[model samples]
Target chain A: MKYYVCLMVVFLFSVQIQAQKVAVFDSYSDLEKAVLSDENTTYVVNFWATWCLPCVKELPYFEQLNSANKNLKVVLISLDFKNQYETKLLPFLKENNIKSEVVLLTDKDYNTWLSVVDKDWSGSIPATLVISKRKKKFVEKMFSDYEELNQYVNSIIN
Target chain B: MKKISVLLLFVAFIVTAAFTSIAPTPYKIGDVATDFKLKSVDGKMYSMSYYKKAKGFIVVFTCNHCPFAKKYEDRINDLAKNYKSQGYILLAINPNDPEVEPDDSYELMQQRAKEKGFVFPYLLDEGQKIYPQYGATKTPHVFLLDKNRVVKYIGAIDDNVDSAAEVKVKYLENAIAALENGKNPSPEMTKAIGCSIKSKK
Candidate 1:
């Protein structure tokens, strides 16, 4: 009976995670600590927003990368306006069915923190950072398609 | 044989162009900015030399469409109006390609300048030649240049983009003040967060 109950709890917990709303992050350090906690794990972190059309276009490619590679985790860090979280970001996420671990960063002081992420980064949306135990890559541009993103992510993961 | 090699080179160019999307290394502090005779909203060509008596310029890369640019519009106007009297004139340039962003067309630029009561010349980086020289990465980017065209500062208008009232560090203004006092602006170059200057894909 205990074994059955434990299985039920595990299933329920996963279901909740599967339908998880975006995790809100009030600061950049909190985000970095949470996302980069596991050094052995590879992460494909993308900075994007709903208002940015190019970001929206390339989002599905990241989603495709997520479902295709279970070991490689993809985190979508949203920079949407805090006020429009309910009106725009949440609905857009639900409509598109974005399944990756998504987080919203409301940190206002960008210039000071951007260099910490990547010296070359200009804080533009659709920027990507791929990290693994052996290597890392930061690109301040969008991936044109799934093949482009998939190949780039795989190159880092391997 | 020559034709075959030419065909191979063309194919290689196409593949690389589609696959790679990296920002060019923009101007660093102390780099001398190039002068251009871009067309202004007034339908006349103007260059840095036009402001003969000024000590320096606040060249701002902005547009009508970007939300971030909209937020800084009035603040930018204030900067231009206030700083011009202090010997630093502001030059607003819309560097985005009109084909990629319809709202950034020349006609719309004129309309925006009128609507916002732009005190400075709002110019177009025709054929997108000038912005690349400065290595501007996004709309609402600023480059504070001395009378000799040396870049003194580069980046955002302030610390807070959402509300000008809440801004703590006025990056551009401080840079202007630094220049007036013959001192280097601390934190000379900073990162910009806005719409990447649109170009033909």
Candidate 2:
């Protein structure tokens, strides 16, 4: 019985990534606190989920953006269900070697937050919100590739 | 850091905006949804015209692979099961192109309907033409129409995406009730996080 208990403990521990600091947001307004930065750094916030194929496809471009620039901040807001955070999300993150920050947003009331995120946003995954001190832009299209992603960021910064 | 002038930045921003912005849906509430013939899982072509006497239609732009759509599958089934006899038809359309998303292939859609015991017509939007016409942007998108083919309610099926048991706002059901009484559905349009419909940009 003790051996079985030890095995379960080990399994649970391995499920969570060691260094990734995942912030949990229950509401968009509450999330605004963390996203609303007054700093000089630009934040490339991508809302995604493990289930979205296009989201998963474009994720590497986001990673590229973060690694290429030291000053820019990349925040991945996962729309994955809270139940899948451990079983599916954590494992995927570890497998992909995700270096950017990941946030698990479990708020299911999308109608309330869609307008706030972007008045015209249709609440689609793989959506990006780029914010700097002077400007904030929301884009609904897929990044397509890393260059497109980088170019868009450059447009915002410059 | 070399700073670009604000005027130059604004021009670049405008160019980027063209690349970023998607074409907004031409549909608003009370718009008439066009009827189209699409092949269903049962190997039959179906259309809204066939259901001439249907009190309403819960035309869901859903697919086989979307996790959000999968989560709402049972709720959609329940909607068909309960409302079919009551003159409300659920036209479940797989709007995602199989070429772009192989998981939403016609064969898989048939398999999904069978396994899930779907009682409604699970149709395929062939040539990827139907969804754009209806302005459906994502899977599990609902466009409820009254008998006259006029769009009455558009958006999510419910408020909760995680679990059906915990759902507080039953948006589609309330809309159905409004239709029965010849009243406008409150909060006629809504939004929910869903997978973007796969197609050529």
Candidate 3:
């Protein structure tokens, strides 16, 4: 009976370790439902990859932005391979102490989803799309500092 | 004797200062090669029209910041060294927004050219207006133009970004070879991977 309890504890711990803190969505409908269900809320979706340097650099700024603005919903979508979810995604979130909802995008066709997100996006990482009630702005460029990001966010929010 | 030495030192400083301030003239491929009067690092003004009698030119958009651009720097030097004598002059252009990316500035461009031992002319595109005209989205984007200044090829240096052996297609080299041999290049356009050309607002 004691041995069974130990096994269960270890299994639960391992399961918790594998699950990432960020919410990942595999389908557009689910993502839309999560964001659109809240009418007054603004959603900031940042598409990033672990391998991309600019994406990694701008992550802290996004975290700061999310913490400061409680009313805004910030979603960090990791474009990392689905197979490497446990190996790459989970550890990155835990290590960074990322508080924002994180999710792994499972779509294989990049161009299709890229166009879906915003037609102006050139399929680049570190890309951000600000979705408000009836306005949307997409920036497909990399930001070197927090001020640059804040400027864009402020423009949309205001 | 002390006064004479001071005067000599001042003259040397003035000469060095003048040399450092010199910037190369910028130009885009597919456009008619303009007669640029910009000064070289050696304090000599070079004109593209002087080389108009040549077979063609290879215009490369590259910078110091991007790792992808750095990877092809040595290869670019080798290509320039090899082909410049064959009537093909390699003109490098730095089109990144200077305010945002200081490495693409005129002084840094000169410093990079000196450090890389670049034999080709590295020009600074100040406002970044010329990059988009040529449709250069990425660094190390090559534009191979014929004698008539028509764009013959636009794309990556090759298919392999990591290793030369893995390259299935040598786009720039193949285009140059075709131009030299009086043949139309096969697959004249291809997608290149590198940092986007930073544009000025």
Candidate 4:
């Protein structure tokens, strides 16, 4: 009937909207490999979480940068509690329409892996690491605007 | 009148120049920290001098809204309760600007302390001058000071943030234990993931 067709359309629309799947990284080395393996692309690895306000606020800038460029790979590493992945993280990703390659960092031993990420990083959220073949820079601060964010990325990529 | 005006301008320039030239440096390990008088949630003023008889102080820069701070609240409470009998004081300071994070206001700090049954003093850095002095970049950052007020250990509470049960290395506990034995704590500085302290620009 007509009513059945309308319900199916709504269901299909919902599925399509939430189609972006998030990759999970349980090991720090796996994530390290992912970052270093793609030599052709400049990796802008950002550590963030659903609970961190600054991280959520500046996400759009990264998404914008990802869409505007082809060589730049914006890897959004979610530090949200592993338990909240299904209930909180997935819903948030879908709601925000994030197009960047998202990954949930599932490492429990932070002390061991934090230094591996960046020696200068004091385990702060909204921190960014811009890595390319030529240079690498780690900043433990929030990017205020898109211009500032792009400047940091372009410096390494270009 | 022109000479007097010139003299006043010179004084003004000198004062501004002095302030700009001397930026406040944060205390590092082995440096003596200056005492600060801050208001607590219980409507009382507190300073490091207040706990004169104590061996050291566990100064935690934490806030209300940060989930990482919330996760460590009970552990902080436990540290205070267990260590209070052993001549140590745990002082929690909220350093995030309230305008940036409304939940971290003085009123909410009092509410959170009461709700969580915090036995220690929950103080507020009202003008936000104290945190930068200690070089605290994130919420739940801790600075352990000896009786001489020298910064002994600085950083996160532990290795595992989410679960306390499965924790292997208790960094804070180890630091306190080292101090109790008259020995310096190994791996004195540590890093843990935390929310950035909101600053009013």
Candidate 5:
């Protein structure tokens, strides 16, 4: 009876850990609406991909920021090719147990919307956009650690 | 008190200098490109002057490892194959520091070229000087130049990176067409999306 109870407990814990639901958006307008829907919360939108090493390395920092802060909304937008949704991205999230809100941005019209994200952006991965109703900060580089990521969150929130 | 003030001033100067040492400006459209002598994977040293009869050059800053660069490798070869006979030589330069990315080392570059059957020159930016001069921020960044070495266009090969078939706009090809017709290329610059070029710490 005790062994059965232990197995059930382990199964429940695994289920909780593997719970990552990803939303897909085909256009920038839909993404913009979702991000701007909340005026009180600052959305920390991170552009990344499964193939980018720096992006994968910094995923935990975003996950920590997501759980610790209440007013900050964290969105991990995957730039992985649309075809890889089933084969690569889903398996990566499941295997790594990424809990943060994930989304697949299927927009192919990059030149039209890259400037909309930031005037200084050169369309590089591991870029970040911290946005609220009153202010916005765009960083076109990787956040080295949790401290640096926390600093960005604090700067935008306060 | 006077010594303390001097010390504070020295500290302020050091901080200011540290923050203000910005990188130099990169070449823009219409700017004359500086010729570089880089060693090719085929074991030949080449400069812009080597292509004596060429009408223009397709200068691409790409490497072997980046998945995005790998995606465009075949297309790059196609460009070289189609244009080499037309006097536009393709010169691919790998700028990633080998110390930072071992996979982008000179040997691998040679191996990739051999596997891909590349007829163009795949060169290594030895001291990592050429990319900064061109202001390339990522792999697969392209700079199209005319015969006089004036930059005609600087950006991506096309709008769609995921699939070659789904592409609606061919930016580089259009720019090359403009140059062929003796006109300034429309939309000379576009954002290139790819992996950041790894630099040594």
Candidate 6:
């Protein structure tokens, strides 16, 4: 009887966890409303994926940036597959203890949204864009340290 | 009976493995290439069919963000200039999601193309539907096609990702040369290095 109850409890818990919400953006308008609404709040949008080694390597800097900058809004968008949200993405986020607001991109076509973010983008990961009311800065290279990321962000904010 | 069942299960596993390993890539050597009508840096339309009469085409999937791709930018330009008159054309495609990677946008692509003096057409694959069709897995992925539009070679430009001196194999050049001479390429495909081609969600 005890074993049966334990088994039932385990199944219930699994169902609850599986039902947890996974972020998916339908359009740029959806993303803008969620994370980019406040013009006064400087936004740092980091594009990354689980399979990308450089992206994984630089994730800590994003975390550090989010924690250190109270005035800035850091959004870490995972480019992993929507189906793998539970299997791959959620575990990664939990393991890293990522504190930034996490969202998953849901656009099926790259061209449609490539220009939506910036006309200069070339569909690369580890790419970052810093947006303020007055100015916007985009960097397509990976950063080795928080200092490099901070320098770029500071340049824009100032 | 038990032993027979075990044997059957092992056979099934082996068959499955073989099937998985032998799956054909989307693009292969000698296949008629599809023309892409994509936007170029100058806001003009560029298509592979425009150069259908060329000796060969070097289609590269590259992006602005990857250090590996950046390292080979000058080399690619050199290749374009050296071979353009010889009926060789270079076509670069950027297939990343703009929302996720705003720097890969068409405007930035134009700026980078002009800034780098790209002799080839830097086209934008806005929807990223074209890359997977070519089985491009990474930035700086090279696909060499002969005049008949057969993919003669697919992979990296060279063996080294960091130092050019350390490059033991010039895969792209070698393949192009072999095709020109009507000879089969020695090392047709090699492992490509650089950023994974960004896929649309």
The weakest ten consecutive residues by lDDT in model 3 chain B span: B26-35
**DockQ (Cα-based) per candidate?**
0.57, 0.66, 0.07, 0.61, 0.71, 0.06
* Per-residue lDDT of candidate 3, residues B78-138 (tens digit): 8899998888888787878878777677777778889989998887765565666665666
Backbone clash pairs for candidate 3 read A22-A102, A23-A102, A23-A103, A24-A103, A24-A104
- After TM-score superposition, the amount by which residue B16's alpha carbon in candidate 5 deviates from its true location, in angstroms, is 3.6
Off by over 4 Å in 4: A1-20, B1-23
Best by TM-score: 5
Worst 10 residues of 2 chain A by lDDT: A11-20
How far off is residue B2 in model 1, in Å? 21
Writing each residue's lDDT as its tens digit, candidate 5 over A7-26 gives 89867765775674577888
Name model 6 segments beyond 4 Å from true: A1-54, A57-158, B1-25
Q: Candidate 1: lDDT of A43?
A: 90
Q: Write one digit per residue (lDDT tens) for candidate 6, span A54-158.
A: 799998998899878888988887776566777999898767666677888755344446556677564556788888884678877688899988888888888
> Order of all candidates by TM-score, from best down to worst?
5, 4, 1, 2, 3, 6
| Per-model TM against the reference | 0.87, 0.87, 0.57, 0.88, 0.90, 0.52
Q: Candidates ranked by DockQ, best first?
A: 5, 2, 4, 1, 3, 6
Interface RMSD computed for candidate 2 is what? Answer: 0.8
The digit string of per-residue lDDT tens for model 4 on A106-142 reads: 8877777888878878777899988888467888888
Which pairs in model 4 have colliding backbones? none
lDDT accuracy of residue A148 in candidate 5: 94
What is the overall TM-score of model 4 with all chains considered together?
0.88
TM value for model 6: 0.52
lDDT of 3: 0.72
**In model 6, how large is the Cα lDDT of residue B195?**
79
Model 1 share of native interface contacts? 0.69
Query: Predicted candidate 5: interface RMSD?
Result: 1.1
